[model samples]
Target: MNKSVLDASALLAYLNEEPGAEAVEKSLAAGSAIGTVNWAEVLSKAMEAGIAPETLAAELEKRGILGNTLDVLPLTIEDSMEIARLRPLTRP
Candidate 1:
């Protein structure tokens, strides 16, 4: 099965009982799992929206999604420097 990377938007949609929840649910049903680096961001949004952490954890478990599988891809020092170098030209 192919792995998909899910950003905050997609995760939030599933957690919030939104329109795209079905699609996300389908993906999981088909064994397509998601990976993310920004877990704290996602968790914070869920908490702010009144989703109990236990509920979220249970849902993820039911969907066969494990928290430990999330990939934390941090920007390297060189990458950060490169972005900083290009920031001025790219800034709106």
Candidate 2:
């Protein structure tokens, strides 16, 4: 199975029963999971929308999702430096 990297938008669609929810579900059924950064973003959005953190956590656990199992790629020091360097450049 090809692994898919789901960004925050995709996860939000799944959680909110949006149009692409089915696709997201299908991906998960095929063994595709989310990265930690995306997971955190999804949880943050859910919390902002009034979904209790514990409830979300329990639901994810019930769905056989494990945070530690995600292929969370870490940001290297150079990557961090680049982001910092580019922040001012992209500022409006």
Model 2 per-residue lDDT tens digits across residues 29-66: 66665656677887888789899868887787776754
Model 1, residue 15: C-alpha shift (Å): 1.9
Clash pairs detected, candidate 2: none
Q: Give the candidate number with the greatest lDDT.
A: 2
lDDT of 1 by residue, 14-75 (tens): 76778897876565455443433455577777789788767776777665575444333455
Shift of residue 58 alpha carbon in model 1, Å: 3.9
Off by more than 4 A, model 1 = 52-55, 67-92
Q: Report how far residue 70 has shifted in candidate 1, in Å.
A: 8.1
TM-score on alpha carbons, each prediction? 0.52, 0.65
Clashes of each: 0, 0
